[model samples]
Target: MTEKTIFPTRLKNNDYKFTVWAPKARSVRLLAESPKLEITMNKEEFGYWSLIVSGIDAGTRYRYELDGNNSFPDPASLSQPDGVHEASEVIDIHDFEWTDDEWVNIPLDRMIQYELHTGTFSAEGTFEGVIARLDYLKNLGVNTIELLPVAQFSGFRNWGYDGVYPFAVHDGYGGAKELMKLVNTCHQKGIAVILDVVYNHFGPEGNYVSNFGDYFSGKYSTPWGEPLNFDDTNSDEVKNYFLQNALMWCRDFHIDGLRLDAVHAIYDFSAEHIMKQLAGKLDELSQQTEKPYYLIAESNLNDVRYISSHSKGGYGLNGQWSDDFHHAIHALATNETRGYYEDFGTPEQLSKAIKQAFVFDGLYSKYRKKTYGNSTKNNSGEQFVIFSQNHDQVGNRKHGERLISLSSFEMAKLVAGCMFVSPNVPMLFMGEEYGERNPFYYFVSHLDEELNRLVNEGRKEEFKTFFDDKGEAVNPASEEAFERSKLSWGIQKNPEYQSMYNYYKKLIELRKNHPVLQVPDKDKLTITENGKGFTLHRWQGDRQILAFMNFDQNDTELEVPFNQSGNMDKILDSTSTNWNGKGETSPQKIIAGETIKVAKEAILIYSN
Candidate 1:
């Protein structure tokens, strides 16, 4: 494969070159719906069919007729104006007028990510809607925004995991041009954009890629279905298709990074895994573009190979989501020991997560009934993206309760402090900074009634272990679920919500300004677990910071674990009266060996 992309329909000088990989088809014809022309395409090498027609340009709708009988949308459609089942529209990707020529990409280590779904982030439910709030995100101290997948799915409402056309932007989300505008506007505002992409399996509905070639394999199975054909026969083209799709986002759409969803489900057994190949190709592109592009993976396997260096016998991706950190904080706060949370819920686990970046490193998990995960002790904290709550952790529940609803406002603040002060990179879900009470329920809209029924039933079955017989799961197919998930921006005016928002803002500012906090080296940090709370001490040369977290129900006094040459001044106290806590209980200054009383469910920071 060359550096040039060969997936989308190429339009040049009033001529459109159509191409499709249909190895099994006896003959393929180009069906131009608008011009009403039927033309046979010449079969090229490697089972590709192509046809070049003049006097045609962008916005023309066309499809491929396989064996001169059945016709389906192009597998590499760039814009599905009429939906996934309709004809694929020709889109000139370079037609947009961009003003981000001087925009520089943010490094992965310094990124403060804010993930939001396009449909629920604003009332318009489109790329333009998100662009309207660029200033709001910038004010919140987020340098990067991670949009949930925008690839064309079945309908207007989806979690974006069900996308069928990887190359096309969703028509409901203002299509390709609007997406380009969003990226361009984000760059102009000094905010980087990372797109979540799904590649484990195509959505059950509106998936026609299999009809073109052997895009799936029956040998390996995922929760959705058979995995993509990565190592099967004739897998080279299949691999190229996805790789080029990734590059198209960077080269054409100017996506800063990608969050690969559930990569543990990607089954491959080749000498050079597809992930390594992708990392190599991305590195080459980064050099050519003179900009750093990151690839972050979402995996629950707790494997360090994804972020490890290639010379270390690993895949060498930029980063991966650290579920152990989320689980540690969530289990401790909610105290709900069901499902995966059963393995967590202790200060010791939280300490391990903060210090080692993985709590289940080669340990036996009661939930899985086996030993899982490798040690990430050698990996830098920059390789992991830590969060207190995300879409899956909140929306997959029966009620989809946020942290404030599930626990308390103080606990929410405490968790936020823990996440920001830790060694790993931090991420915030939409509406979390202000303690939005709206439930982000798992919702979708599929045209097929049978598929919708199955989705509802499957959601119920999946949550049976987490809830008892009395708990009722929300119907994912209902319109109410999707409508209610939208963020209520009006709630930010409330005193309590405003306090929470300010607290998060302060934490982010501290993290950005402090050198000790900015460095993600675990070697310079120490964690000590008390009976009901823990203390974290991070130091670089002469500068040092100490965090005292109390998770108990009542105030408790604990001796300072570290020695101090002089009195340590207080920095941030979550229990301060300004943050709507009960009252300020911590002292203004801390001595070397004195025991200080810490308010329950609060976090205190001190520096010298």
Candidate 2:
């Protein structure tokens, strides 16, 4: 059902009917500190306490005081202007003046996503700060911007995953109104926003879901905490709690898409898995609103069924983050083979990733000590989201060093070439475009001192297990980590940063303009090793483009099967000099079986 059927369609006079499914409470009163008012509840047959407060306008601070004590944020609060400990605030979605109506949803197949954390994407660390950079994103040719979760967490600084109130906007990064403004501005610039949501666990401090009912199950456990009760006796209500939360973002907040966090950890043995239910609901909602909706899963399971459409007997998600692809690329670029990397790291593995989404598809994993991952052979490349680096891959590291720090500039350019030219949807972590040097260390803040100590000790212990060297461990709870992660906006003005930025823009533009890049035909993508480098081929109908890469330290001769070309034109090159040492050139042609010298760490794009 659309918004027209549920609640007052127009929301006339700015008044609202507030209701929540809190049955055990003796008394429930609406506590709006400013413009103070009280509301009494009417008990229903199901014991739900509800009350309608008239003249309840938007931007009004409010909360519920149970039995005249023990106040908490509203379960359905549209905004938490204060932190999670404080009262919630009422917000009118229609009150905001939105500027975008002509924006068409960017198809998932064509999406070149740029992921950013609001607090770190800019120096200001606010929604308004990001709005100033819309033209930068548009010029970079990105169609979708995936944000880390913006739900209200406890402290002023957080990664935003441990959010307690799924309905409320994070006050630290500008309240709900400003968030809506950010989305509105992004849409106006023809960019879609995809929010990353965590449903598996809640934060430590203000988590109050258990107060209502048996929302968590002791039967199962996650690495973070207790597993959500999705298959227990009261599983119906527990499921509804999360489902409604998802709907609230899409329906009330007008979010375009969601990236489901770690679905593999969501233990559900029900007849209808939570993912299936979510997919079905999103499908219905999309049809109701006549807007394109998408679901992307972050699963280490490597199960292609997670993305398969429901009609085709799969989960029906639009796409999923391919960690296999990330791991292979990251290992090759940095050569860090700890933990899961013990199983994968080879030139062959990287080549396998070029054809298949995952390197270990149904292969025996030495790390897991079992066979893992499903084959992605039949799936289109668009079903996978590949990245050289992301928040987790960077922040979760020992020091949060980016590819620019770990590898040379030539390797950096080569990594970009692989990501942009590959068939899968490419995602650039924030600051990666300009090779920004800031580290994205994991940061958190806890109210309890013991908990803070435990987090720091645990971090050190985890790293000790992987790498024996022990240095000063980053205390996530401290103010320093958050400050360090913030991007330096001034980096864009530097000559080196500008050159790298322009290179990214050109790559993205080429990806968009070239049909061969979007061609999902698995047969069309072919990779062959020639000399010390690799030659990648993607056929666009009858025509073909060849991408040659030399990963060796010294310039090497590449045997070109020249009979495959009529006339050659250099489409793109990552070198300072041509085939000869004299001058700049595009595409150089040679004999049918002649050999050509390819510069070290260079990428050459040839069109025939």
Candidate 3:
């Protein structure tokens, strides 16, 4: 089951060839617009119908009629021009000119990811609008920009997780041409693009896949509803539906990588799991293209098995998102211990997260009231994607409070310093570098009135543990909520905000060029704390670096000496007044027995 066997495929003469898997269809018809043609499609083995129409070339609007009665957009549509509820437009992916031949992505060890929602990232909220901010990201030293899903979700403004049409790019985002242009521009700017794709469920509106075939299962259910029928009868075609979408994004769209969203919700009980198959397909495609195609998973399960090699009976994914790092840092920095943060907030927990990607490895979980997680099995730092803040951490909150609103200026810098210095790959939420004041709230434009009401009510109920007293929830269905979430690019003009922005760039520069920070040996990275401060030591070949950080509001002294055989050289000092701090500049050196003094809520690094 390759390209033409399932999706829209064009012939050598440039005519259109369309194929769809409709297992339970009594009659299938290709109803095309422009000329108003209703051509009968021929049936094939395993319940597939296809038609080769000569006159209907690319950019033709079409839909399928079931039994000459019900009509729905193609499940594999490339572009929904009118809307998801309307007809799907035909698109020839080869028509677009791509200029990424000279673009080669940097290694994962040197990656600095920046996550952004295209809608709220700019006022225009289009793919072209993102191009205006590319220079800003490039100047900020970000080598990667991970976009929240851009697939054809209902309406214009969404966080994009509720995408119903998996194949089409949202028409509101300037459609396929503009999206490809954005991808090309990112590669040219030395920034790799990772698209966050959701396969667990579709949005509550305009989803018609289940009408044509047995696409859902009754055995296993997800938070959204019945999961995709992966282990059920007639599921082979359903599996191909999602599998083809993965190959299309990589081989067709030139996406450097994909961030598989909420993999925990993808319930599959089969001999060959969907993740393994998807990873295997991408691996094969990568070899053909001669460019690395990464498959990163967003599984909050904290199970390293998701990223482990398939040969060892694991999924063999390139990386998985690490919630432990954020939870540990948030608890320590903000002292919030009401919800999931109840299990975090100690130097030991943070130390464990730094040493191993998971803090609760087969340990007891107060959140679930049971034991949870397993050992990472000592996976490489590249296998774990760590971030101080991301979409879910910000947008899922009752108030959509970002780290800037939760921590102080110096604390924010310290958080950045520690993340960049760590061995794990680091990511930053959009507007975090520039200190954007606005929140990244969750907003959607579902066409169904009742569905939208339930979603808004459920969202408010979920955050009951966060607020001391519940107030009327900000209507997620409101246009104002979505408008307010847009990134405030104005903060870059303020001097203090500019300093914070520069500090982030400086940290990224150190991460890219510094030898000690480039080291991937997690075993060589050590953390120890006494009272309100901790010291982290890292070594790579002949290069060694030591960092002293104080978490207390008052100055804290490191008990151990930092002389390191009298070969130490000052590297980074977050306490300097240059960073808008009240602390003095760091000293050139410290004698063998002299204890290092660290300014409150700051970090200092030295190299040897």
Could you tell me every candidate's TM-score relative to the true structure?
A: 0.98, 0.93, 0.97
lDDT of 1 at 44: 79
lDDT of 1 by residue, 346-457 (tens): 9899999999889998999999999999998778889999999899988988888888898889889999999998988999999999999999999999999788999999
Q: Which wins on TM-score, candidate 2 or candidate 3?
A: 3
lDDT by residue (1-608, candidate 3, tens digit) is 33334668888987888998887898899999876899889998878898888887777899999988988999888988888899988888888888899876767777889999888888899988999989988988998989999989887778898888988898888888888999999998898989999888887778999878888888877887668887788877888888889888888888889999989988788888889988998989878888888889998788877788888889888998889999998888888888899899998888788888799889998987998899975688888889889999989887787887888888888888888877889999998886776877889888777777998888877878776375666789889779889887775478778878888888888888888787556888888886657788888888888888777755554455664675677777887767777766567766565677677788988887
Task: Give Cα distance to truth, residue 478, candidate 3, Å.
Answer: 1.3
Q: Taking the tens digit of each residue's C-alpha lDDT, what string does model 2 give over 267-327?
A: 8889788888888888899888888788999998999888987777788888899888788
Worst 10 residues of 2 by lDDT: 1-10
**Backbone clashes under 3 angstroms, per model:** 0, 2, 0
- Reference-based lDDT, each prediction: 0.88, 0.77, 0.84
**Candidate 3 global TM-score:** 0.97
Q: Which stretches of candidate 1 lie over 4 Å from their true place?
A: 1-4, 9-12, 554-562
Error of 1 at 552 (Å): 1.3
Off by over 4 Å in 3: 1-5, 468-470, 554-560
